[model samples]
Target: MPSLGADMEDGTLTDWMVAVGDSVSRGDIVAVVETQKGAIEIECFEAGPVTDLIAREGDVVPVGAPLAVIGEADASDPNRTEIQAPPADPTPEPVTSRPQDPPVPSVPEAHEPTPIGTADASMSDAAPQQIRQSAEEPKASPAARMRARDLGIDLTGISGTGPGGVIVIADVEHALEDVTPARPLRHQKDAMRQAIAAAMVRSKQTIPHFYLSHTMDAQPAIDHVTRLNADRPPSERILPGAVFLRATALAARDCPDLNGHDNGEGFVRADAVNVGLAIALRGGGLVAPAVMEAAELSLAETMAAMRDLVARARTSRLRSREMTAGTITLSSLGENGADAMAGVIFAPQVAMVGLGAPHKRPWVVDGTVQPRTVVTMTLSVDHRANDGRKASQFIAAFETHLNRPDAL
Candidate 1:
C-alpha cells in the first residue's frame, strides 16, 4: 500500500482496475484502496504489461507490499518468481483466479506501484465472504460498492455506465435519486478523527514546532481581483483564497526552507512547490490534497484546481498521489472566519501557512491611519528543519507577494 498518509499503516484493497496481461502506463489509475480516509485511486508509476495480479481484491496488504507485477515484454523467462511472498493467512483468500502468465522481470523497488494496507482480524474474517459475493456480483467500482452498501441499494438491478458495464459512483448516486431520497454519507468520521488525532499526536511528540504571524495589507489584491472579475460572470470570478494560495506557493518556491519534507535524516527541499490546501470535509474530518506544481500554475488554474480538489475531496474521490505528494500545506479561514488563527504543522512537511479572514482594520500607511482590508497570516515551522530567521523570511516573502498581486 502507498503510504497515503502518516496515519495510514494499511488499507483494504477494494478493487483492481487492471487484470493480468493488461497494459498500464505511468499515472494510470490501476486500483482502488479503501482506508480510514476513503477509497483512494491508486496510480501506476511504471509502464509495461501487467505480468501477475499478486494481491487479490479484499486483501488487506501492508504499505510497500506489491499488488501486481508489471514487466517488460521481451523478458526471456516465462515462469518468473512471484515478486514477493503472499501475506501469511488469516489474510483473505482469493475469490477467483486468472491464468498464470510467463515469468517477467521484477519491477525495481523505486518503480513499484504502492498498493493497499492490512486490516484487523475482524475484517480479515469477513473479507473472504465479501470477495466471494463480489466475484459473482455485478461489476462495480470500489466507490460504487461502498456507496451501494451504505445506502442499502442492490447492485444487481442497476445498469453500469462505466467502461465494460462497470458501475461507478455516479451510477450508484443515480440509482438513489431514482428511488429513495439522498441520505448523508456513511463515512467513518470517528475513525477518520482518530486517524487525524494520531498523526497530530505523532507530529507534536516528534517535531519541534515554532510559530510566526504577520498581518498583510489585502486591498491591493482585492482591487486587482475586482478589476479582473468586473466583466466576468459570477461563476468566472476569482476568490481571494486563490490569490493567497498563489502568494503562498510563490513564497514557498522562493524560500526553500519552508518548502519540503524533513525525512528524519535532514531537510530535503522539493523540486516543485506542491501546496496542500487544508479542506474540511462536509461530514466532519479534514483533508489537505495538494495542487501539484502550484508555483507553475496561473491564477485561474490555481483557482480551478482548488475548486476541483475541494469537490473531489468531499466526495472521497481523491487520487493516491494527491494524498501523499504535498511538500507544504496552507490552511485558510475564508471571509467569515476568525481574524487570525495558528495552525498545527502537518508533519514531515516542515511548514504550514495559515490565512485568517480578511477584514477592514486600522493601519498606518505612510504614517496615516486608514481602514485597509487586512489578513492575518500565521506560519508554523519545524524548529529542526527551519529556524526563526528563515521562517520570518518566508513570511516576509509571502507578504511581499500579496502586496504585489499582479506578480502572484
Candidate 2:
C-alpha cells in the first residue's frame, strides 16, 4: 500500500483483477485501492513471475508494505510461471517486453516461434535451463506504471488489456469510470465538498440573516498605504487586506453586538477574535481560512498572516488550526469587479462582509461633477442574532473604520 493524501495512512484493497495463476505484464492494472478521496487503480511496479500472492483482496495495507513476490516458479521446469504469470514465457528474457527510455528504446516481442512446439515436459527435462527471476515475471507498460505510481493503486490487483497482459493508460481510465460496491471515484473530493455543503446549509437555513450595504471613500487609505510603502523595501509593502482586517477588528471591538451572535436562547459573545478570510481557488471552490486573534495583531502582522494563509490554502496545505471559528467574516470579490457580493453566513458567525471592486465614478460636486473611487460593502447578518438597527450600526461603524482608517 502507498500513501495517497497528506492525512491518509492506509488504504483498503477494493478488488483484485488478477488471481493466482494469472499472467500479468509490466504496468498492468492489477488491483483497485479505496483511499479517502476515491477508488484508484493500481499498476504492476515490476515485471516478473508472481510466484506467491501475499496479501489477499479487501486487506488494508500500509504504504511500502510487502504485497507479493515475483520470480521464477522453478528453474528446472521451463513451463513454470507465477499463478499470476503466464504458463510459459515465450520471451527468453521477460525484461525485453518492457520498452527502454522514451528517448532511445528497445521493444522485444514474445520470443516463441510462430509455431511454438507443443508444451512437452519430455523435451524440457532433456535440456533444463535454470530459471532466473526475469524469465517468469509479468511486465506492464511505462505509462500504466506512472498512473499507478501517482494514484497509489497496486498493479497486481488489476487486470490488463494489452497483448501479453500489458497494462495501458486506457485501461486505467476505464477502470476509474466503472463503479463498484465501494465508494466510486472522487469520494474524497465529494467528502470535502459535503463538509463545505454542510457548513453552507447550517448558515443559510438555521440562521436569520439581515443585509446592510454602504459606500465609503478609499482615497485616504490608498494614500496611507502609498506613504507607508514609499521608502519601505518591496518585501515590506503594506497590503490593503491587512488594513481591512485591522479596521474590521477595530470595528468589531466597538460594536461587540455585531461581533457576537444571538444563539436563540440569548446573545452569545465570542471571547476570541478569529476572522475568516474567504479565498477563491483557481479552478473553483471557496474556502475560508481563518486568522486567529486578529485584534491582537498589528496591521503589518495581520497582512503577513493573511498572505501566508491564502498561499497555503491555495495549495490545499492549510492546517486544521487555520479553519473556521471566526467571529466575523470577509469575502473579497474585488478581483472579479463584482458590484456587490452577498455572503452566506457560516453558522454561528453573526455576520459576513463582502467588498466590491473600487471604480472611479463622477458624482455631483457642489453643482459640478467630480470623479471619486466608488465602492460597495454588503453585510449579511443573522436576523436571529441582530435586527435592522443593529445591522445598520455595524455597517456605520465599519464605514467609519474605513473613512478614518488612520484613527482605526
Candidate 3:
C-alpha cells in the first residue's frame, strides 16, 4: 500500500471497484480506501490490466508494502499493470498429515529446578505478553489502561481487539456500550464528528462571528412549493429546504461581497454561488454538503440536487468535494421549528443563514389581525468581511424573493 498521506499509516480496503482480470485505464477507480476521515476512491496512476490483488476488502496493510505487484516479470504485455496472480499457498509446503509411523522417544521431565530468575527471564523472552504480565505490569495499550482505570475494570479481564491481544479503546467501548446504559452511543459519531469538532473549534476561536435574525411570513414559500409540486409527481415534490437553498443562492448573488472571500487587501468574489444544506444524521451530528451553482438551478433542479445530496450524506458516500467550496450556506431546522438559532459560520466562507421552525402566530395586516405561518431566519456573518448594512440589504432582497416565489 502506497502512503496516502502523512497522517495515515494504514487504510481499510473498503471495496474493490475493479476486480482481477478487469482492464483498468488511467483515472479508473480501482478501489475505495477508507481512512479515518471517510472512503476515498483510489484511481490507477497508469493504464493497464488489473492482475493481482494482494489485499482484499478490509485488509489494513502497512504503507509501501507493494500491496499488489505491478509490472510483469518479463515486462511483456504493454497493457500489463501487474503480473499474473501466483498460486495460493506459495510458501514452502509443510507436511499436512504426519506419518502414522512410530513416534520419537519422549524425554523425562526433570524434578530439579534451575535458577528461578534465569528461568523466568527465559520464559519472558520465549512467551508472549500474556505470560509476562503481573500485578505490577499491565500488558494493555494506553487507551485500554486509561479506560480500565476510569471504569475500575481490569484490562486483564476484558478481551482485546488490538493486534496480538494489545487491549484497545474499542474493546473497552464495546464492552461498555453493550453492558452500560450510562455510556453514550459513541459509535454513531465517526469521522465527520471529528471534522465538525475541529471546524467548530476553529470557527468559534479564530473567526469573529455575529448573528442577524429576521422573521418573515412563510406563506409565500409554502404556496410556491405547493404550486411547484402540484402538477409534478409525488417523487418531484419541492421541499421548503429547496426554496431555502434557492433563496440563499439568490441572496448571495444580490450581495456579491458575502459570496466572496477576503484576499488580505480587498474581496475576491466567486462567479457562481454554492449553498450547503445542513442535514441532521440519524442518531446525532450534522453534515453540510453543498450543491454547486445553486443560484442557476431551477426549482425542479434544486429539488433534484437536494434529494441527491441528502441521499449521499446519509449513506456516508459524500466526498470531500461535496462538503466544501460553498460560497454561502442555508441550514434549515424545518419543522425542527427552533424559533431562531445562531448557526456557526463555516470558516473561509463569508456567511451562513439558518432557517428556523415555521409556526403560527397572530399578525396585524392593515388593522386586521390574522393568524399566519412565520419562519425566522438567522444570518451568521464573518464580521471582518462585511458590515451590518450589507447583511440587512441581502436579507431584504431575500425576503422580497421569498415574497414573490411564483417568479422563481
- Provide the overall lDDT of each model, using Cα atoms, as 2-decimal numbers: 0.73, 0.58, 0.61
TM-scores of all candidate predictions against the true structure = 0.73, 0.54, 0.61
Q: Residue by residue across 62-112, what tens digits does model 2's lDDT show?
A: 434555555666646665432222211111111222211121011233222
Query: Tens digit of lDDT per residue, candidate 1, span 1-408?
Result: 565764343577899999888888778888888887878888887677888887999987655566788784445766443332222101111111101311111123112222222221111112232322334677764435544665678898899865566665557767877885544354366457755765676567666788899898999999999999999998778899999999999999989978987654568788889898999987689988889999999999999999999989988889888887788899999889998878888766889998999999999899999999999999999988889999989999998999999887
- Highest-TM-score candidate: 1
lDDT of 3 at 40: 51
lDDT-better candidate, 2 vs 3: 3
Query: How many residue pairs clash per model?
Result: 7, 32, 1
* Candidate 2 vs. true structure, TM-score: 0.54
**Best of the two (1, 2) by lDDT:** 1
Pitting candidate 1 against candidate 3, the one with the higher lDDT is 1
- What lDDT does candidate 3 reach at residue 237? 88
Best by lDDT: 1
